[model samples]
Target: MITKPQFKSNDYKNGLYLVATPIGNLKDISFRSLEVLAKSDYILCEDTRVSKNLLEKYQIKSKLISNHKFNEKKNTLQIIEYLKSGKLISLISDAGTPSISDPGLVLVNECIRNNLNIFSIPGPSAVTTAVAASGFSDKFLFYGFLPEKKNQIEDEIKKLSNFNHCLVFFSSSKKLNKLIPAFKKFFTGRKIVFCRELSKLYEEYIRKNIDELELFNNELKGELTIVISEKKEEKASQKLSESDINLIKRMINKLTTKEITDLICTNKNIPKKVVYNFCLKLKNEI
Candidate 1:
């Protein structure tokens, strides 16, 4: 906890200043972000407790307010009034860019509706960080985090079924057990990469295809950025291999749907329900 003041007070415009904080490593924060945060009249953050650590780090003496999921809508009106009164308000999330998958959108929109000046001091973004690491650096689509309900998740995946771009999703470790299965069902034949705990010391990247979805257990922990590539590129040989597919095809004739589903799930480490669905799809095709 090196607490020497790293920033000096500077004059920022009277509006909402969106400051990007570090995703994991505190040092990943930018100088401009520090300057904006230091100069603001007050700081609105997703979690005052989380932002407290950041503020304490730089000795950022600005006042802190809680503006997260629950209170954002209610607080937006007050924030709008604050901006109208010509005060520089800084908005930051627990980590990464504000409004990407966190609170700040409501406040930003409220500020916009009132024609208040909005400044974005961009820095760390898990979306771009994961995309940059993902090999499919072509056209990309960030779908934020998946909805919690099962039906909503299914509906969202169905809507994006024909999407050809690299689909990106921010999923929590808990929801991933269901979310990964959704990806398996909808994005078959696509290459998937799990960027876990990105930029953190325990950072991990697990890449696999929708078909070869075995062996990667849902026992994974930490924040996840799941990227599914559109088309199978020839850059690397298919790890699952054509021979594996041929064997599965051969088994399709001998094994019952349930038996085949059980075998694949056991072999691949995928969830039973997902493997069952995959087998049903495979059975329908042949």
Candidate 2:
């Protein structure tokens, strides 16, 4: 059995502590997380009631302050003053790591610029957990959240489809119906994994072809992180013939095959191996 970290007495010395909390499962909370919350002079959280539940569960009695997106600007200054006065402050979100798809980046950046010490007690992160279990490439782009508008989402997906890296983004179950259709339109023929309720008892990873993701989206629940595989480039670009390759080579004969590969690999469109193979096949035939 794994032992949780004990909330150390002196961990929150000064400055800000960004604590990672469990998304759903209380057991997901880390040892240092409990420690930071216990020792901090004040806790700045997204939702007081939500944070209260976690704190009360652990029996932590620190003061709680609301610091969400709408009021973060004002609260940040207040937090800075507290830090300046040598008070220990902790920033936590309702679930998962702070400032990810949630809120916290602005304050964290401000704290860093002002030379305040910032410590992160890492624990459960939906982004990392989803990516780790995705079975996709290790390399990925964490998009955090998708655009709210349909056209904007299509444009973004089209732009990202050019890359070979797996892309991850957070979405809500309410938006899953619309989002899955847009994904199918812009990113067809790619593999996608929809991770829901990560680390919870009902945690699930539904892997499907982008074309088929719609059916699975019907019964989806809880918060979601969608991981879409980069579009298949060679299949998209395979129409280019030996003649096209020759034309490109002739246009830039002075460039090396590696250089040519780099140029054609624009946006991770084609697999490097495919590009290199095309260069070799064309070079020998020419």
Instruction: Mark the regions of model 2 whose C-alpha exceeds 4 Å error after superposition.
Output: 1-11, 215-219, 232-286
Per-residue C-alpha lDDT of model 1 across residues 1-286, encoded as one tens digit per residue = 5645455444566788889999888899987888888888889998888999988888889999998899899998888888889888999999898988899887777777788999999899888888888888568999998899988999999888777788899988777877767777888888888898888899988888787786445478877888888754334222434654566677888998788766665645455665556556778997
Off by over 4 Å in 1: 1-11, 215-218, 232-286
Best by TM-score: 2
- Residue-by-residue lDDT tens digits, candidate 2, 1-286: 5343456566457988889999888877877788788888999999999899888878889999999999998888888989999998899999988988777999999988899989888988888888889888878888877788888888887788777789999888887776777787878789998898787778888889887665452556777988887655555554455655665577455778888878777764456777778778767877
lDDT score, candidate 1: 0.81
Cα error, residue 26 of model 2, in Å, equals 0.7
lDDT of 2 at 146: 76
User: How high a TM-score does candidate 2 get?
Assistant: 0.78
- Tell me how candidate 2 scores on lDDT: 0.81
